[model samples]
Every structure is written in structure tokens, then in C-alpha cells.
Target: MNKHGIISLGEVIVDLIATDLSNTTFQRLLGGATVNVAVGVSRHGIPSYYLCKLGSDESSEFVKGQLTKEKVDLSFCSYDFNKEICSVYIHLNELGERYFHSYVNETPDEWITAEELDLEPFQKSKLFYFGSGTLFHPIARKTTEQAIHYAREENLKIAFDTNIRLKRWESENQCRETILSFVQKADIVKMTEDELLFLTETDTIETGLEHMAKLEIPYLFVTRGKDGAYAIHKNKIEHVPGIPVNAIDTTGAGDAFMAALLSRFHDNGVPNNEAELTEYTEFANKAGALSATKLGAL
Candidate 1:
């Protein structure tokens, strides 16, 4: 949390990815869009700071342990006395796709409100990253809002991933409205083709990028499973091919892609040409593919 590193503000939860919890053993992994990205960035050899509140609980310790194993900076992370784990169960379909089921009402990640958290880490960051997961709760939303404001004021690039967790929100309207609010604050917005349709209420990726463009966001990245990805910036568009992988679970592939892209951006400015964009996109595509080979998010 010192300075001059990437800062990720969002939830870090425990994900129990299992095809059948009753019959088979469930795999435990530290999951959550922001947390996954934080680990992804660190694994990419970037100085990444993961800012989230942990509880004085074993599950929280597991999250910290995962981050520590990845060598992520935890200077801005806090601990809550009344800590509880954000547990989620994931089911896989015939195609290896995942569906999440969560009964947890809350987690300690929301305890770090804007007023309580130290903004110095965010201020010193060259880029700030988040996702829609943080907006599920009011306390976490306030913290995310403050970080966005600070990132914009400092002219630091803001990276966002629209990770819609239906289990976390009470209503779709509430979720959609909050997602738009954060989208307006992001400099670069990353999401899936399906997420683009759901979040922006658009049928096509072009329309989603168009909506982001009108919001003054300079860049947009859309990852389309096996179809690869599309990138639009400054009215320029490019479609990058996807990498083929026998994916077992795509739990955090998109987050990994976001991390790879942000890591590239942190080291070098935005790609200025089709070639550069293609190279960057391919790099991110590999990162995402690598993630799918694993069971959990991070």
C-alpha cells in the first residue's frame, strides 16, 4: 500500500467450486473478481496491492495466505474482529461452465468503509482496479466510490470488470443501476459479451462499447469465451482471436485477463495501434486460458 503500484479495491471471498458438494469433495480457493485480479497481477510480476478487510477467522487467514503466497502487498488490508467468510458453491455443467450459489449475507470485505480505510495507498497507485462485486453492499460501495473519485482526480488509470454476482444483490435493477454508476468512472472497462448485454442492456458488443464511449471512457474490452475478444478505444475497434484450451472451470479467467491487460498498461501506456493491441490481447488471452486450466479463481 505504499505507492507506485496497482491497487485493487473489492471483495476477497472463499469459493468452494464443486460439481457436487454432497458426493464429491469441494475445492477451496480464494475467489472474487478484485482479489483474483490482485493475485493475477502479482503473479504477472507486478507490484500489486490488494485492499480488502479480513476477519480474525480461519477463512480470512486462508485468503491472506493465498495472497501472501502470491507475494501481493497487504499493507492496506485490514482485519475485523467479527469476521465471517464469504462462502460460495459453484456447480459445473456438461460444458464445464460454472454457476454460483451463495448463502452468505455478508463478509468482512465490506467492513472497510471509505472513512476507515487509508487512501494513501490508492493515491500512490498508478492504476486502481475494481468490479461490480464491491457495489453489492452500501459500505463497500462507499469505499469504492471514494477510490474512484481519487483515481480520477489523480488522473490515474482506472480498470473495471463488470462481475455480476446475482447472489450478492437483492434486485436486478439495483445491480444494473449501481453497475452503470461505476462504469462511468472507469477509464478501461472489461467484461464478457454476455456481461456487456446484461450490464449495458444492449444486444451487441458494439452498442456496449458505444455506451461506454459516450460515458467518456477511452477504452473497452470484451472477452467472448472461445470467440476471443474485442477492443475499442478512440473509436478504433479490433477483434483478437482466442486461444484454445481444454478448460475445466472458467472461474476467474476474465479477471486474469483484466490483470494481464492492466499489468501491460502499467508498464507501458495504452496500445496505440492494431499490432500493439493484438499483442496485448494475445498476452491477456493466454493468461485467461491459463486460469481456466485451474479449479478456483486464484
Candidate 2:
């Protein structure tokens, strides 16, 4: 029961990314924000435990095989023959920006429940990381909340990423409320600039901060593509410049950043001072930028 590992709970799906803007040809890969973070952290030499229920299908096997190959621990995962893994078709623009085109989900109701979760991983892990993808479903949302409660009881650091997909939710208000509820319980929160604007209903980061002032999120990272990211800790904001790199695909850059940041925290502990924060964020920015230079997220 090592306390250095990270536990990530969320959906793992197949990503059908268009080879180009033509939208005719696609390359299938195993991807999901939380899944990317698990693999990315594992690559950083940290023990990453992934928690999910996989189905008895080819796509599910592919996802599981990829996770195994990535060196991520699947000891806490489950399997069901009745359910099939989800697939998402993503379209990319000339700038390598991704558009979530469509989703093919057969068993939306089939989610790993809290009762099914093994508490041993929670005891052995140092951090609990998750995203908003699973929160749109009532059953999965209950499971996520239960997991969060377990994480709190274990005194594990909780990190939440607002990997917002508007198409998944019933309404904007529900999305904001559901995400904000989880945000309040997190020790660390990561979001893209667009996600921040959407959640806060504000035009800019400055105004978004004003809207989020009362929530008092301990550490918030708002990433803005090549412009780098703004790291807000204890009311002090520092702009960490993005590392320069030849752009390719921006699929899982934020997940890369989150994984790097969490890996740094796992190794050296969370940065408490400005100097430490800068060094940690700079390291993460480099990882994120490097990830964008690749085609697939994994």
C-alpha cells in the first residue's frame, strides 16, 4: 500500500480523430481526459491507478490494453460483458483545435458504483484526480461523490478538472452547478480559459476571478493555449509562460499539464512558495507544450 500513487476515476473511451479537416478519415485511439492524465502521470514515473468499468468489447479491450501498456495500474478497475465502451468522433481545424463532433454511447447507464469500488486504492493513493465527463449521469455522479467522500476520509489531495463538454449536459445551469459543487471540494482545480468563462459566465479571466472570489479555490490553473497559463494560489496570480513548440494537435494538453503538476506534487510535495510554484508550473507547461506537438493524446 504505497502512498505515492494517484487514483483517477472517470470514463475511458475511444477517440476517432479526423486525420484532417476533411472529416472523412479518422484515426482511432484510446483517450479520455482522466485516462490521459493517468497515462501521463505514469510516464512521469508515478504510480497511477485508474478506476473504471470496462465492457467486453473490442474497444474496451483496446482501452484496457493501452492502459496496461502505458504502465497504469488497473487493479481497481471492473468489467461488464453487457456494456460497451463509448466512442467519440473529434474533428480538428487547421489550427489543430478539436471539436467534439459526436458521441456513440450504447450503455450510458452502466457505470461503476461506489459499492463496487475497492477502498484499498484510496488508502494507498496520495491524490484523487477526476474530470466532469462522468458527472452528467446521475448514477455516475453518485459514484463520483462517494469516491470524493472516501478520498476526503483518506486525507488524499483532490484535484478536479472542468473538462467541460456542453453537449453532454441537459442545460448550462446544470453544468455550472454540478461542476461548481465538485470544484468547492477540490484542493486543486484546472480549467481551460474557455471553461472558466463558461462556468463563471464572465467575459475575461479577471472578471471570472471576481465571480469565483467567494469560492476561494486553493490552487487554480487557467490554461490559454500558446499564451501559457495563469496560476492562482492564495490570491496571488502568476502567469506561467507556455513553452514554445511546433503545434500539432491540442487534444490532451491540459491533461498532460495536470499529470505533470500532480507528479511534481507527488515527488516533492505541493509548492508552498512563489519560487517553488513557478518552478513546478514551468515544468508542467513544458510537458503540456510537448504533448501538443504530437497527434494523439496517449
Candidate 3:
């Protein structure tokens, strides 16, 4: 196996996005934070692998087809015959903001175990990516912990997104603690301003970053909706303003940002210097801005 690519482990689900609020029209799109990142990396012509569990159903087939079409390696995707497919009902506000109603109570993606994971790819990959949401379930949580340990042992660069979904966790404190633990493990950590507030228990961005800096997190990127994004390394911080666009749906913009950031890092051989980091962050911010211009989760 090649040790120069990326491996993303987490959930993948079908998104039923409402096309019209006035009517019952909706469009089903294959999306999950990890899944979207995989597709985004593939679209950027990077070698990528998606590690997840899918049900033996139509939604599973649809997801597989999309992964195949995008040229993402799905050799590690596990399938379970007993469980139903996972899905999310996305409702968009008039301002283009989105909300979700998840139908993943009994889905296979919530059942990924440590024994089911093949750590060979994690050992070989240059980068390993995962989000905080998958750590909610016991089976998937154990699998994630195992994978992170293996990646650390192999000296693979780990990137984590603090994609905190409040509805999925048992309690706010649990989510914060769990996500902070994972953040401590990551070589690069990405989170939105709101997520940072939740994680650090601070109201302002300066105080939030200060709190995270105390954790000794080497690299941190804070995204602020339409305002822009901020990147911090060592003691230096840089802010990149967001591009203006008529966002019809802000569904996968953050995932797009992460994918582009990782893809750039992967392409640049995981920069070891400040100059390289700056270059990558600028390019990644642009990729994220472009994603917001589109309607779907692409």
C-alpha cells in the first residue's frame, strides 16, 4: 500500500435536501463530512480512501456509485446486511442556512468496530482524517481511537475537524471533552468559530484561540461563516476574508475547506515550514469560498 496518500474514516449518508420550502420537493445527495471530504479530495486529483460502513441497501448502492464515479478508493468500506441505510433530512432557511434531522438511530455506519478496521492503510497513509461526530457511538468511537493510535505509531499526519453536532451527543460537556481529546491528537485541527466557542467555553475569538493555545495544539484554523477564516501556527495568526457569493445552500462548505486544505498539504508533502503552511492555508481558503458558490454538497 502507498504511504503517500490520505485515508478518511467516518460516516457516509444520503442527504435529502429540500429544494423548495413552499413545496415537498427535495433532492437526495450523497454527503457526510468525511464522505464529502473524500469526494473533494478525489475531485482535486488526490489519491484518497474512504473507510466507512454502509448498509446493503439502495442508499448504500447510491453512495458506492457516487464514490466510484468520483474515483475514491472504497476498498475499505464495510457493508452490513442487517442494518438500514443512514440518511439526513436537510431543511434550508430563507437565508440559505441549513438544519438537519438525522435518521441514523440504527444504521450500519454507527456500528464500526475496532476489529472491523484494517489498519494497514492507516499505517501507510501520509494523512489520516476523521471528524468528531463519528466518536459518538461506542463501536465507531473505539474504531476511531484504534485508528488514531495506529496512525500515531506510524508517524502519519492526523487532521481532525471539530464537526460538533449537538443533537448527536449525549451531553454538551461530553462532546467538548471528547472533541478536545481528539484535537490534542491531531497535527492539524479545523473548527468553526461557533464550535471553538463551544469547545473553549469562551465568547470571543481571541479568548477562544488563547484557550486552545493553552492545550498546545500545534496548528489551528478557525472558520467564521461569511466573515472569513483564521489560521494560527506557533504564536502567529492570519485571517483570510471570505469571498462574496450568493449562497443558495451552505451545506458542505466547511467540508470542502477541509478537503482542500488536506489536499494541498498532501500535495505539498505536508509542509514543515511556516512559508509552506501559509501558502497552503491561502489556497485552501479559496477552495472553500468556491464551494460556497454552489448549491449542492459538492
TM-scores, one per candidate = 0.89, 0.93, 0.92
On lDDT, the leading prediction is 2
Candidate 2 Cα errors over 4 Å, as ranges: 18-26, 90-101
Q: After aligning candidate 2 to the native by TM-score, how far in Å is the CA of 210 from where it should be?
A: 2.1
**Root-mean-square deviation of every model:** 2.9, 2.3, 2.4
**Residue 129 CA displacement from its true place in model 3, Å:** 0.2
Q: Which stretches of candidate 1 lie over 4 Å from their true place?
A: 1-3, 17-25, 91-101, 106-110
* Every candidate's lDDT: 0.80, 0.90, 0.83
Model 1 lDDT per residue over 1-298, tens place: 3446799987777877775534256778787788888888888788888887878788888887878989988888777778686887777666666676544635444467787667677677889998888688788888888878888777789988888877668898898888888887788888888887887788877787776667666788889977789887777778998999999878788888999999888887788887887788888998899889986676
Tell me the deviation in Å of residue 139 in model 2: 0.9
* Residue-level error in angstroms, candidate 3, position 50: 0.6
lDDT of 2 at 231: 86
lDDT of 2 by residue, 61-142 (tens): 8888889999999988888898799999999888977787888999989999888888889999899999999899998898
* lDDT of each residue in 172-250, candidate 3, tens digit only: 9999888998899898999999999989999999999988898777778898867778888886787877777777667
